[model samples]
Target: MIDATHDTNGTRYKLFSFMTHDVFGHGQYVKHALMENEGSECLTDAVTSFKYVNPTWEKVRVIIVEKGFGDISLL
Candidate 1:
């Protein structure tokens, strides 16, 4: 699933909010999919929430791309 909100500047921000629990022996996984507003608070919130779930988990990698014509198409 996805959640979206508009910022003070009326720019639309998208966040991927979903969780999977007990995937592998009580391990919890959170997936933050596509984010529209890069460098915005929304992205920070997404990363924060993911870390909050499992603080010990290390970040494997990260990739940032500029917003474009259609987000859904990227999905």
Candidate 2:
């Protein structure tokens, strides 16, 4: 989880993770995206949703966010 405070607004990201996408002949590439706000459920609702939606994606370990905005939590 990552949390940061800013003058304008604070942002929070929860359940950060990394995944790999394999291209037939080109080899495998690391793919990941961070979703901020939305609270703890973001993992179950958003992160896990991707896993269910994209069956081809391999499970990657959860990422440790060292820097970000607002208050975030790992699910």
Candidate 3:
């Protein structure tokens, strides 16, 4: 499973199991977006820019989890 977390600092992503290989394309897309906006004010801004540039690439699925202090589990 692919997991991700976002906070004030930035977005953190991790992939569990070998199935991660299938997600390289998605990762590349995100990387390219970030690279295009080299000096983005925040991660949210970068993502917004990406959507504006590529309107066709919509419907990204993300499982947002709320974790308390010291909690380290995928939701």
Candidate 4:
């Protein structure tokens, strides 16, 4: 999926997207965060269970993920 500025002719996102919160809301309508090595490590580590993403997955909303999946593909 492509996230950028200036809407072009056409674009689309995946069935499920991987995005993080921009606490400060620095720029654009959508402020998505990139994956970090620390997060990747956390995802892989057995002791680490989950990370709460307040922006995308609001406090009331809930989704399950595998131990190391930053993205989801049930199909």
**Highest TM-score against the true fold, candidate:** 1
TM-score of each: 0.34, 0.33, 0.29, 0.20
Provide the lowest-lDDT 10-residue window in model 1: 66-75
Candidate 3 Cα errors over 4 Å, as ranges: 1-41, 62-75
Q: Report residue 9 deviation for candidate 3 (angstroms).
A: 17
Query: What is the RMSD, in Å, between candidate 2 and the native fold over all Cα?
Result: 7.0
For 1-75, candidate 3 gives per-residue lDDT tens digits of 222333323443321211112345542223232222223244345445556765654455553323431223311
Worst 10 residues of 3 by lDDT: 12-21
Candidate 3 local Cα displacement, residue 31, angstroms:
4.4
Give the number of colliding residue pairs in candidate 4: 0
**Stronger candidate by TM-score (3 vs 4):** 3
Check candidate 2 and list the clashing pairs: 4-69, 4-70, 11-69, 11-70
Candidate 3 is scored at a TM of 0.29
From the highest lDDT down, the ranking of the candidates is 1, 2, 3, 4
Tens digits of per-residue lDDT, candidate 1, 22-47, equal: 54646243565456664545556666
lDDT by candidate, in order shown: 0.48, 0.43, 0.34, 0.31
